[model samples]
Target: MGEPLATKHDVFQAIADPTRRKLLKLLAEEEMPVTVISGHFPMSRTAVSKHLRILSEAGLVRERRVGRENRFRLDPQPLQEIKQWYAYFERFWENKMAALQYLVESDEPVKPEQ
Candidate 1:
């Protein structure tokens, strides 16, 4: 009946930043503490941690405590939302490509755009 509740950090927003996207890729390989993650980027550990927090809020990353360290890892389940959103556009592009293919194969020519 009502609209879905908004999250503090949606997957779209979480992954909007290039830094956060890289963080996700890095975490995808394995869980790592802030110190290890910070080593990959030129930014400060606090900056990296901020990005991780966003990803965690989006459910795109999981954080766990190992000793005194906070380790982060990729949780790809949230990416399904992105995949589904893009899949609709994929179908649209596929239809356009198919139409272009038909036009190319037929006698009709595609005129150059001015």
Candidate 2:
């Protein structure tokens, strides 16, 4: 078995930019043309296109050509890997939160303020 091919555009890199993340949210509900997607951001359509390219390379977004127009939609499958990666750390935070709750709800009642 050979190692996986190295690609600069991974899920992390794809979503690293705020603009790309917004693009994902916009496409989450429905697929839209590149021109429409570009409207949501302050940047130029060409800049939006660049973000879309990164997203497509990372497997986070899928693009389909409808005649002369290109439609983009969220794939979401790649995001599962990111969710799973962060899930491992959730337990630590949960534990800390539980401990804080216990301290706040201790049996010893708080003294009346003087």
Candidate 3:
């Protein structure tokens, strides 16, 4: 059998940049051409497009040609990986919070020991 397919980009790495994260948030609102998307950012359109390209490679953003321009929109399915990753750590936080609550609400006398 042929080797398994490889991803062109890693979602984690793709979203590591603040600029790319802003791009994702902007696209989440509505699909827009690169020009419109670039308007919301302080950087050059080329820089914004580069960020969008990384997002597209990671499958977090979908792009399609419409008329003479490319429109981009958020495809949040890939973000499930990030959510699932955070969920693992969430359990640990919950456990810690529960323990803290128990300590705070316990009837045991407060004692200071060196």
lDDT agreement of model 3 with the native = 0.85
lDDT of each: 0.84, 0.83, 0.85
Per-candidate TM vs. native? 0.81, 0.77, 0.79
Tens digit of per-residue lDDT, candidate 1, span 38-98:
9999999998889888888888888899899999998888788899999999897678767
Cα deviation at 103, candidate 3, in Å, is 11
Better of 2 and 3 by TM-score: 3
Better of 2 and 3 by lDDT: 3
lDDT of 3 at 96: 66
Local distance difference test, candidate 1: 0.84
Least well predicted 10-residue stretch by lDDT in candidate 3: 1-10
For candidate 2, lDDT tens digit of each residue in 1-114? Answer: 442233358888888898889989999999999999998888899999999988888888888999999999988877876899899998886786575543344577644434
Over the full model, what C-alpha lDDT does candidate 2 score relative to the true structure? 0.83
- Backbone clash pairs for candidate 3 read none
How well does candidate 2 score on lDDT at residue 94? Answer: 74
Error of 3 at 86 (Å): 0.8
Winner on lDDT (1 vs 2): 1
